[model samples]
Target chain A: MARKSKHSRPDEAFEPYEEHAGVPMPVNWVAIALTIWGTAMLYDTGESVQESLQDRAEDSDVVAQSVPDEGTLLFGANCATCHQPDGRGLRDAVPPLAGSEIVAAGPDIVSRILLRGIDGPLTVVGQDFDGHMPSFDSALNDAEIAELASYVTTRWADTTEATAQTSEEVASLRAEIGDRGSFGGGAELAMMISSLPDQPPMPARSHVQAGDQAARDLVFAGRDQVWSCASCHGDLGQGDESTPRLAGLPGAYIVKQLQNFREGTRENESMQLVVQGLSDPEMTALGAYYTDLRVPSTARPVLSGDLKRGEQLALQGDWSIGVPACFTCHGPSGFGVAPNFPGLSAQHAPYLAAQLANWVGGQRHNDALGLMAQISEALSTQDRRAVADYLASLPPVPAGGASMARMETQDDQ
Target chain B: MNRYLPLSILALAILAFATLMLVIAPGMQINSRPAPEGLTPYSEAEQRGRETYVSLGCLYCHSQQPRSGDQAPDGERGWGRASVAADYTYDQPHQLGTMRTGPDLLNVGARLPSEGWHLTHLYQPRAIFDWSIMPAYPYLFDEKPQAGPGDVVVALPAEYAPQDGVVVATQQALDLTAYLQSLDRTYEVPADGLRDHGYGTPDGPEPTPSEEER
Candidate 1:
């Protein structure tokens, strides 16, 4: 080894050797740290991307699942409001789906009920559900008909053991009906199918009479002095322009609304003032009376424009502007599907127009109806008149009628 | 001495840069607060009206955002734009709500022509809209005594008078009118009406429609 020069210090002596070294120690540490941080950031970003993709994939899957089983969505959207999400049915007025003999009966009986709505007194699951469940035969396709029937058969009542129905079966039965005529009562359906068990006998007409009288007396009498129900609702409860026709409404729905009016939950200053003095018994009586009255088509207004315009608007909303047609939920005749949507046919045109305007103006509040209001506001005054007139002019499809069977089946699905 | 100068200069520059970043960067944010180009500050009465709206839970059913799609019935109903974040720079707690029991209220004040009509409709919906299902807000107005012949009816207040010089106003009605008039949403930038393009965000250069041999 050569001796170091006297001018070079010990640290300076190493400098010549250090020149050959590749990277400094501190730079190496920094490089490693940066690499680690970059790796972590990339990992997090990848995870988030994966999560987002998974969510989108799941949503698409749900849509795909819904398309094939469209009946499930239809049933949920339409019937779940009244029959409940589980298909167990509602209390008092609606029959149970749990172990009903009716549901377990032959498919023809069920199809008949779907084709024609049950009118007069009826019982379900040992409980009375008197309201009409309208038919749906014309609205849904044959495939939809099969799907709904299958769903109802497999899901509700004690139908786990019963054989499921096919689209061909529903289509065959539809053909026999010949242009979708109405089914009068359970007896008629029973007569058509010998194997089907008879429906419970009709309740005594006297019971209806007594209920009507009690309701009439309560509605007619007022504290001090005021207008009677007849003054606003008209003689047979065929409502005029100022008020809605109350006849043919489901009793349970009427009772709930009347109670709401009296309690101020569903507030209208005029209605509140009108109902303010009535007792609960009186409201009940009023509901019973209204329910007993027969609905008359004569009361419905004759529309001016082409029914086609109304039909187009009702069935297929002006999609160019993203408007949903009214019939999607409110049925073809404007008779609402359930307790959630009130009947529109036979309703006063002025009342309909005002309600539409009010909904647009924010003078009313209903989550679903709010959507309708938004859509309604887009309409010109003339369009509103035309639509309302068309709805008013539509014939009331009779309860338990064949025309409504498809509608009922689709609803159940 | 000269050899050490470069190192010292570099160290000083780095320290100075860090200090400037720490001290000055926060101040930049103050001026950076977004201001939607066309909006103006609300008037004092309008401010009060906004407060009244918040207190009344009006946001529960109504939304401020209008959909971006071409003239949905909702837009035709005069509920203004599907709100952008820029539209709510002034809002402390944004009122772009979700429930829709009633129509959107972003441009309600400008949409409805008459304040008196709103008042009457609010007071007695059934009288005006027979199928109205909304709860009445009678507390908003003082009940006018049932008019009797020869009971010299006082004219409505000067503020309540119609803009066309036709009608008079009540105090409650005036306050409510102040509130409704405050709902002007004219500051919104109109969407370019392009079918697929989203709002606010700039898209590619506009395509000019061709004239057919004009």
Candidate 2:
């Protein structure tokens, strides 16, 4: 293209335009071979093909007996990052789908991933995956996403029970979830999951297993520099009307609170002082000690709010006002999720309301991704009070898996 | 044979040779490489999102190809290492636009991983970049008087955040953002790929590294 030799120099040797004037060098065969080899390398690996033709062809011979599973293809394309192709995830880095808690937590938990995407640390099989999964809300249609969710849940079942979820079910849930930014990460997803029905029931006994001996000793008798938790909290780990009852709370939640107190994440002069001289083990032990103790009484309403309204808020949140039911994150039956989310089953109303208000005011926000902060800010004081009082009124609830009661929800707000 | 017939035949042969080199060779050169290690095919979502990218005519402003440092200052500008043909293996009608009125998006996903940041920037670019000439795509978002529960509140600057309501990203905007997020080409180029391998074929070992290293 550079030198139109005939056109440029009509006078000079017009007969033979056999050779290119651009370069005197011949084509580099080494370069061409390496290029082909490199290309073959990429093709063999199958990381970046359009249809993955070769992979499909190879699989067709053996693995293609079943109807072309759209979900498998979709998962290989999308969900394989955190959830592997085989669904055996990479340790704490990504969660495995082989009997993943969220995948089988029911359609609402996992289907929401396609629509809103999930972020923050998620606990699957009790291990945390800190990565964020992007939303496919606009990416995939209802039917495609449905098939994908179905594939993962059923194909990866603990016993291959083959729970086939229909596309209609996915369509309905999609319409229900509507458009929201990523379910605001896992805490919110946990809350949403908790609200769904047919959840695993609470344990028979409260499961108040004992704590570390060293920590139990410290709870009763403060070590050299520290004071005991029993000063304000009752000897039995039960709190008075003003103080929060710590008994039977999840160990993770208890430890987080003590850590929060020490770090000023959840500011409290008393707790800060109590935790000041406590070392990591002492703090962990204190958390364990409280968790293991069984309280004689559940939380009661020290101050009054509308019990009926509180119950309504606790059980069925005012979605019109952008408030999710309290138990969504807390737990089914108002008992809290362990470690991070405290059970609200027997929490005192005034204390709960105060904490909710703190979330609104940005005074207390140690919750993952500051989820409580957003939820509380959207709530009015009365809504917070209604939910808190309702929580306090419930009888003691036993700890159970996170799957919440299945309830139909509004599309957006 | 007539002298004019021989001359005409020579002219025709020359013309045919030019066509082979000029018309067909570049096309072959464009696609002669394998996809790089980190490069992945577009997910269904990203594929759907790409439609938004195309429809919005982002190509008019943004380019997806970055030339090597020797050719341009793109490397110094942090556009990433020079793009290779394999980088576009998954791209259909690759968006190697000529005009670069906006930054090259060859490695945007690596540059900005946050969807929120992208959504906000799409809504009103100047909100974040005070001197930006890119027009705002307010239509790609919904303005709500008060954000509903589960609504994605665009993290706009105070000036861009609506005085009365909140702004939530529209599906198109989200799709486009996903496509943008999928525009990563920051994969560690294979040893041969990092060389002067333009079409997965290198003329010589890369000049920067030692000759023995190759």
Candidate 3:
């Protein structure tokens, strides 16, 4: 110490045991990391640190358990098929649910229809329909029907008339109706709901039957029943507005329809009157005459519709609703399939739409196994119009001429 | 190079495992299933028609398999119920076609029961429908001055018929019609294997519930 050598300074003795570098404490770094992790958790998850654990636990127990729109789900499942989601009904076939008087009248009528299923000859909004609505009592429970009814009422019924249905009310109505067949047509239904319009009586069943006359008159000649086929149908059997063209139709098909009219199985007010005086032989003669009569299509499309949709229904059928293309059974171009399926090409649009409506209403049920009735039910009013217009636009016969061109082709072959 | 034997053994084991899992197990399961009720064996004529259908590429456009309601509206479309594996017991090589360019033929017989309609349709599809894009099978028919005894004459439209002769269905055409008419799978099957797929296709526009509905 006395020498104070050149190698060592006096300040070295005063220095502490260890040098103090300007580093922060380890605890400070850990605190900063913890703050960042907590911030990230709160920002990304939209969950606070206090409630995140609780939310996860509750989520596991009731995952996707919200039942907010129960009525919507039920309506879509049960009534949406025929009545349509918007409840407009399938025009003159099924009745409209939107702004429907029956729906507006309140839950009593709605509940009864749901439980018992109303059959037609039911008049809704001045339009007559004869559909066969299958009872939903067996298919849906009281609660489900209530939900469906409420949904329909709320969505389509007039706002002033909207009434919510309860399961209790539906249950009581179900008990009151008990087990019964469909409300006997619309008359019986009108009795329960006075607000509903009356369904007009079906054209009285003609007492007239085919007489025992051996009349061999041609189809063009006036008979006792009709003045002449040419009066309503053209001279060449080319039909007018809303009248189906009889020209070039299959003999078997015409005969079958004539027979159907005579038997009163197929309901046609005019045809019934006409067939009453005709014998089986006379019917056969008319079939032959019409089958032989080949005329170009002069019947223009009267009903307005989407031609594209009509073409699709005629050519590619809307499979979405289970309707096969018109060509599938009616033949390639709407020409009649012999003995059963009729030719739709060049047919009157109004007539086609009316027939489709008839099928939907169950007024015309003469189709094989109710095929038309089933298919027509699936088509909307717009779809029916579209198909009708499309068929009316097509040639009744193949392009070029008729048998002459076919014969020429055969000769060439 | 020395590990060649081990490598080959490993590859053989893997191949055997795949075969056992994929082919053998499924084949055994399918073989054990019983045929559904009313599933009768194909008749001689129907079998021949089946052969004709296979040869004619009818499967290219028409499907024999009508899927469940949930998958498609085959039932509502009047194609009958969904097909089951047991439904194919009579089929030598099953015709569960994938394409639906045409309607399903599984229940065509039920929908159209007339033999005459089928014959006419086969002879000339356009004779019944003027706008049908389906190719005509005029070759399947023979034009004769008059139908002979036991000959089935096709009832065609006046324009499509030969001016001097009636069109008679050939044996092949008859067989094909018979086959089409025989495709009736409308009988009920056991509910065990039948699944409910719901109506309409998956791609169909789903109705979204609005806020008011909620």
| lDDT on C-alpha atoms for all candidate structures | 0.56, 0.63, 0.67
lDDT of 1 by residue, A68-179 (tens): 4656765654455446668777565455656666667645566656654556445555554444555555445566666666676666646446556677887887787654
* TM-scores of the models, in the order given: 0.36, 0.33, 0.41
Docking quality level of the chain pair in candidate 1: incorrect
Clashes of each: 26, 14, 17
How well does chain B match by TM-score in each candidate? Answer: 0.58, 0.80, 0.85
> Proportion of native contacts found in each model?
0.00, 0.00, 0.00
Off by over 4 Å in 2: A1-413, B1-12, B23-32, B148-150, B191-214
lDDT of predicted model 3: 0.67
- Model 2 lDDT, residue B35, Cα: 64
How good is the docking of model 3, as DockQ? 0.08
For DockQ, candidate 2 versus 3, the one ahead is 3
Q: Sorted by lDDT, highest first, which candidate order results?
A: 3, 2, 1
Model 3 ranges off by over 4 Å: A1-413, B1-8, B28-45, B55-57, B60-89, B96-117, B126-142, B148-151, B170-172, B182-214
Q: Candidate 2 chain B — worst ten consecutive residues by lDDT sum? A: B203-212
Model number with the top TM-score: 3
Q: For candidate 2 chain A, which ten residues in a row score worst on lDDT? A: A403-412
